[model samples]
Target: MALPRVSALRASVRAQLSAQCYHRTFHGSSARTGRNRASVLVAGGAALVAGLIAGASRIQRAEMTGARVPTALDGKDLESRCSCFMAPPVTPLEGLRSPDMKSRMELLIMETQAEVCRALAEVDGGASFIVDRWQREEGGGGISCVLQDGKVFEKAGVNVSVVHGFLSEESIRQMKSRGKSLKTKDGKLPFSAMGVSSVIHPKNPHVPTIHFNYRYFEIEEADGNKQWWFGGGTDLTPTYLNQEDIVHFHQTLKEACDQHSPTFYPKFKKWCDDYFFIKHRGESRGVGGIFFDDLDSPSKEELFKFVQSCAKAVVPCYVPIVEKHKNDSFTPEEKLWQQLRRGRYVEFNLVYDRGTKFGLATPGSRIESILMSLPLTARWEYMYTPPANSKEGEILKVLREPKDWVH
Candidate 1:
């Protein structure tokens, strides 16, 4: 009975072991399938994550390289690494490969001021110009050099300025009224101007007082368009008329203008006469030189060359005249006449001179430099008339009527 019971127990144990083996095989296959599905899900997640990272990297690269970086107006780089807050980068016009006009004009004007001051100093012999360098809070700055009580010149000023800032609404409206092509989104307009202007007053009444100015102006629009121009002239005002001196002066300017264009002299000469006319006094300001504005056609290089020619001709045009009459003797009456003529100059500048108006209207302009063109002393007399057919009378006649000195 014990043997029979042991056999039955062994059979039962074998059946149990077989059942356990079959369950293990079947569950193992199901577990393997689940693990494979988990691996596929993980691989898909990793790929999705990689794609997201790649897209983010591309966006960051586009932000860095797609837009133009900003730079300071003075061409200096800003300290910050993030360029989004930087000043607008200088954008040249499409297909324009030349240097920036404002920068070029600034360099040219500064060089011209230095050269002119040096030459005038040599001619002065007794005094040298005192340079006053100043800056504007708005955008730019200038150099003002003045000489007083000199051997050849009583008072002289040579000033060079490079300014950039926003134009007032009134200024924009005025400019638009003058037929300037301007497009402003807001009332304000961005503008840049660079110029060199000089005024020379001689002690000797016989020597003439001369004025010269050359400038470049640019208006930048909201749509990245630019409007640029060149304007300038040189004139002579003598207390005593000297035919040879006046003729030489006009001829020098004519030659300079002719080098650029034959039409420029005649057109600009007439323009000068018309512009400098003292409408109230019904007389011309002085013996006319060449004057022109809105000169932008025929290419910027040509205009630049023309302006350079005019500037270079200045020393030759007036220096010899100064040297010639600087030693001449004059009476107190002649000196008084010179003062009266200066009064007329003051009137013209204060009333009708566009340069003076612009300078005074510009924000942060240096008043001293703007008014430096005025004589150190001026006199206004009531009903003053020169003796008929006298030296003063001859000059008055010329001033009252414009003449073609070169022809």
Candidate 2:
């Protein structure tokens, strides 16, 4: 039997939202800030806006573009525009020229990002990338292409998610677990499950790395209530200090946020940092970007608009940086060391990452794509040392403290 297409699901959702009278307001505390510790605010009742002011320190920046914005969240055209805005062009799938569905999406997103990365690399002199991959104990899988190699970018790229059987009840359980939640029905715990192939990695050092994801989830009830949702977003990270990059990245994101709510960028940026942190390492993966999940809130139409806004922000925030950095020359040692750092990336995902844990626990999950973030090659050195108080050491210092990326 043929399975349901996501596009079809999206269309159905669009229609349902179009026919409804929907209005929502968002009120929540700001995300945890790294500095002030007390700047959290209670924003107005704009479901479009959630208030949160975080911190700042050292980093780079970038932007992206792709999507149209509605003047008000109350417009009738909101549903159609939001759905059309965020969905990837179908052409990439055709252009990917691959057999596997996941591979097709992976290659397509990679091809698109590589072109953008190459462009930014040409402009930035050069860039760096962080890559890692994982194995899913279940079925199906995916790979990520993150590029930050450029002047305009701090980092950016599309996260391609390809997974079959995503709507299975067991799969939903795995996803909830990753979020530190569990499934319960009739006042008792149920079985867990999930399967997927996904990837995320940026191509530049100056722009700081970033992440984005798209996924499907489901919950099944003994009484037959089946539910599902689509979730994902892009976020930021940096290695070396670059204030312009940080500001540019944040500002571009703010533009998208403002279209929806003045409070969005601030709240989501903070959320991005908190969401992507390596709890064990006591530091964020990079600077920060925007993130959202289980976005099935208020109404699918409203959530769709929010996702569209984030999707549009991607190209504007990241392409320029890639154009700036993809071609600069770097010594083989630097590249090798980059790979060595990649080793740490791998360690975090395999040993401490919630995503990895969930993916491995799900049923019908694919292994290769789940682990595709890993570099083609990587290394580990015994007791590697950074010159005391050097710029390199300075980055290490900040990484240890979870410093704010912007003031």
Candidate 3:
């Protein structure tokens, strides 16, 4: 089935909100005393204002847009003009072709979050997601949907964010170090980023934990040049070895890739294996699926379609496996093993995961949303070992030595 057109939905929501709201942009400035200050109205709420303040670091010294104002507008006016209550639509990039890539990608991710969460709720049959809507101070916000202690899933979270802001020189340098060629006249880059990220931890040890994220990023340069790229992948982590499940997972991802490019599956599968490797432990994080970054190729339209294809494939690839093993019986010992494995998952995220690091470092990042990928529970047993021939041991072998699941 085709994904929902969230762009239209977004427009509809904006129309509803517009009738009840007016525009007020909070401008931030760094005074001569080197103290950062922002003119903000508290009409919406403290939390909304706080998010904008946290994100205010991106405003440059000279780019302050509005005059300082202390008090919020009186009563009804204050309530009407606050920008904090609603997420502003992303400003469309000028000179771009027919379909606005920024809007298109953002809608796709938002809709995917809704689709995935709905499907997961149906599969869980007992728990529904609680949605948290938050706005970024800079420009935009997101919805974080989470379900905990479900019949099928122990903890699952799917979050979608659309944010645009100026990138500091330090941030640009970091990206350049990672092979991103970003340039700006005033030593700062204006950027827009949007994506859907999810991680699922099933109640049954037989059901593997799965994660997937797809994102689109654009950086505008000083010379009026704009550079854009796409990045994403999915991977599986299981406590017990099941070749059929692993094979099906890889094959499903491969079919998605093949529809876009014959080389995508193989290339990205290897990339996933490399990207998710826990270098210190000398092991792969999971049976790799597909991962690719900095993808700007045939055309924006083509890449957008390719990304949509991959997003659509996620449900089919994972739901069946959850259905097959979610009811399977397991022992306390098996549950313990899963906890230990989750410990490794924690190690990788805290130590080596770029997303975790980036989110932590980002000025306006929501800590709760960023860390939502972590499992509800985890354990570390010093010098623990499983029987050499046990199911847990078998899975460890594949993790230690990554496999070609679809071969």
Give the poorly placed runs of model 1, Cα more than 4 Å off.
1-98
Score each candidate by Cα lDDT: 0.68, 0.44, 0.70
Clashes of each: 0, 78, 1
lDDT measured at residue 199 in model 1 versus the true structure, 0 to 100:
95
Candidate 1 local lDDT, residue 102: 66
Candidate 3 weakest lDDT stretch, 10 residues: 57-66
The collision pairs in model 1 are none
Better of 1 and 2 by lDDT: 1
Scored against the true structure, residue 81 in model 1 reaches a CA lDDT of 14
Residue 377 C-alpha lDDT in model 1 = 88
Using TM-score as the yardstick, the better of models 1 and 3 is 3
Model number with the top TM-score: 3
Model 3 residue 114 CA deviation (Å) reads 1.3
Model 1, span 1-407: residue lDDT tens? 01122224334322422231100001111123322111111110011111112112111101100123222232112211112100111222121123556655554555456445655766677465555556677877676668887777889888877778998776776677778878887666899888899999988988889999999988889898989899998888887788888887888778778877899989999999999989999998898898888788998767877887787667667776777777778889989999999999999999998888888888778898999999998999999988878888888888888888876
Best by lDDT: 3
